[model samples]
Target: MSENLNPAELQKTCLYDRHVALQAKMSPFAGFMMPIQYDSITVEHNAVRQKVGMFDVSHMGEVFVEGPEAEKFVNWIFTNEIRGFEPGKVLYGMMCYPDGGVVDDLLVYREFAPDHFLLVVNAANIDKDFAWIEEHAKGFDCTVRNESPVWGQIAVQGPESEKVLADVLGLPEAANLGFYTFYDTEYKGKRMIVSRTGYTGEDGFELYTSIDGTVELWDRLIAAGVQPCGLGCRDTLRFEAGLPLYGDELSAEISPVMAGLGMFCKFDKDFIGKEALLAQKGGEIARKLVGIEIEDKAIPRAGYPVELEDGTEVGIVTTGYHSISLDKSICFALVDKAYAALDTPLSIRIRKKVFPGKVVKKRFYQTNYKK
Candidate 1:
């Protein structure tokens, strides 16, 4: 917390003051002054794994789509099938360019109203994503609104999340809802949403409400001794859970098909990137994402070259770590498709030495999502 950080003009979330008051390790992330850790990354990570932890994800962006053509418009831009999705249900997918590059990966919440939907996007891509959305919406008979400035969101995650949310917050309805579903209700005379979607691969709930309500909830949760997590632990938890970060795993150069997320992209219907993705699937794609487990304790970092047994460079590591939960060096890498098969011998170049490893399942840790 004492290191001199770069003085870049950054945006602040609704809980910025709370993090500062706690003396959290604040860093610039996604153009916002976000908390990297409160006490320790490992402590906060473990709290979310064994008990319950909370993250002030108020910096995430929110967009509202409403009109007679809302459903049609969303389905056109999104990769997933939202044609007949029921209200209160949420779908995770990507918005793509005509050439199949990802604009952003987001969660779309179907509202109870027949002609309305809400999109929760990444914090860093807020401006870019909204502009893309607005551009594509020119011909549609719908209205798009970037409501990120007014909304606040918090993710309460772990095995004990339900109990904490129900007992501490008195939101019993949260317990009644199932995974990937949400319910809208009034809190302190203001509208709010409670959704079950865990980015950490744990049973969790993300509460979206007014900024004041978010602050009050944070205060109460802290008073009740729930560990306040930050982006550092959030990254580790999500990585262990086998979730993909947008810029790292899926980017302008990486498509959902290339990242092994083709399951989320529906091909039966037409979308903005349908033809390009279809062509990519039908053609011989050069690179694909795979998991590599190194035998040594050497931690692999991003941009480190992945090599063949003969010292030929095949690809590079996208994300890697000495996994806290698994206690091994592992990473996600984009490699030549010819070498992506299970049990293929591979090596990662760490600084000056090449460490041998093998292709393994990307999901290094088993998740506990309560039914």
Candidate 2:
């Protein structure tokens, strides 16, 4: 689903000029003028898969949580268990409605400071997620601040990302960051964070700094020959790795459990959506997300219908592509639980023709993420 945008009132990120100078294909995305691609999508996609690439993700939203009740409050609202979480650790989880529908999937970083956290959320759901967090925090003694406008972020992704961050950016501390860990430092006296995290399945890091620092860092990476990537490849890479996009695989109506992401949701801990999720667990799951591999060369796309052999529709494609890395047509579809089993035969109605397919593992490509 696309973000609501007037097109006439698109916003710009901190590195808008840099993208323009690079002659990127700019388009309105999530209320911002984002780069769809600097080079060909294939080239950029491969750059990240093989070597390194960077994205201007300054449009992503960041929210700060602080107070005496921050731990308890975050734990209550989040599906992941982070009670008495250690500083520098990052956890991926979703905030779910009481009915078990997802509010938003986000990365929550327990800051080094006591009772503080940083939540990095999707751009389209920034305001909505912040409001949801505030509304659920009525009785809690924590303060929530939307720091989206203050931070500039970039993701350095790929196999060589550690060397790039060390040699190019000269942040050797980043090389020592374990997966899902972060360390705070100063960049030109502004608070900068280097987190060993990324949307792409490859081991990488997302650096958050001030707007000016972001621009400077972007220039540095560009000058050092790091491929300036765009959202086009970002989507392909994440899709290849079977990561969920908020409005797609996971949404307000698609619970994490239905998306086969129950592992990230902690049931032992009291959470906003735990009871409903447990109820869903006890009952029949009507639908579930699954992967489909088409036999034909025709690509599957979002909104395409999935059907049984007789053309009886069961579900819709959430995201699909002719995978650049795997050289196969793969897609994630939310379908009836009866047909969600691996190897269950299915078909995708691409346009006029229905192509034969079968359910497979959602992870179409094996990831090379470093531990």
Candidate 3:
């Protein structure tokens, strides 16, 4: 954290200088000084939709788990099956407490060795998650280290990501890594980890390199025809893809199942939230996550009330944005189970006036993945 920044401590990412040099609009996000847009939000958002764009996601947290008991520790703590994920593969999962409340949503990337792995978590929840994981691994023969400060991450996403990466990034048979898998490589003599995973619903690669090499990598990619995208587009892109944001769609009070991530849960595995999730499964689900399309021009915002025809509030909007792809206002909500049906008519209370809306399938935008 830097001393010059205020309240939230405007942390700097590896590409902070590049953003300033590009004359980007800077803002505080998740306690970091991030570029909200380089040119314009909608223009950058549309650029990524059509071509490859890079993001400075170095503020994300990276934790290392090693030793013989690493696998056991992770399997017991996360609500996903680790055994099924082959080495060099990646899986999406959540860390939950005993009561089934989510700690954070994370991507678990298996290393070349079974006893080693990297956990990429949200920036804001790094300390909380690291403390929790460390305390849980007390007796286990595992070492948990917070390596976020030493590393930097960049997400190169969009339809043309493959072409851009193939030209700029040098790795070992790098292009051959399957989707959701990663490969060890070297860029400019520095050891790097390139994963075929990205938050955007686009076919892209996430490059993890040493903090020292961050600026060079960003420059190289930009020179290789990858546009620098900002946090604004990142949010709109992920939201349009129906990917849940940590604070909005998931949190300490929100269960993964309630966030429309029931498929990621392994019922057979006895995880921290297994008991509660199982109990909730046996009975009817009280609330369900759904996507809503606003018909009016008013953009629905988070914390807005979701009401029915009779003006009865049924849910609350969790995330909302103007979709560059859909050309409409879109939002996600945790509505009562009965209101989760597709095409269900609903209204979003915006500035005291109800805007017409309807529940729709979440994949509001499609992803282009390399087969």
Total clashing pairs for each candidate: 0, 0, 0
Model 3 CA deviation exceeding 4 Å by range: 1-8
Which candidate should be chosen as best, given lDDT against the real structure? Answer: 2
TM-score each candidate: 0.97, 0.98, 0.95
Q: Show where candidate 2 strays beyond 4 Å.
A: none
Q: State the lDDT at 153 in candidate 2.
A: 97
Q: Which candidate is the best by TM-score?
A: 2
Q: Give per-residue CA lDDT, model 1, range 165-284, as digits (tens).
A: 889999877988888999998777788899999689899999999999899989999999999999999999998888999999998789988988888899999889989888888864
Taken over the whole model, the C-alpha lDDT of each candidate is 0.92, 0.93, 0.86
Worst 10 residues of 1 by lDDT: 1-10
Instruction: State residue 322's C-alpha deviation in candidate 1, in Å.
Output: 0.7
Q: Note the residue pairs that clash in candidate 1.
A: none
Residue 87's lDDT within candidate 2 is: 97
lDDT of 3 by residue, 271-343 (tens): 7888887776665468888999988778888999999989999999998987888889889999998889999
In angstroms, give how far residue 102 of model 1 lies from its true place: 0.3
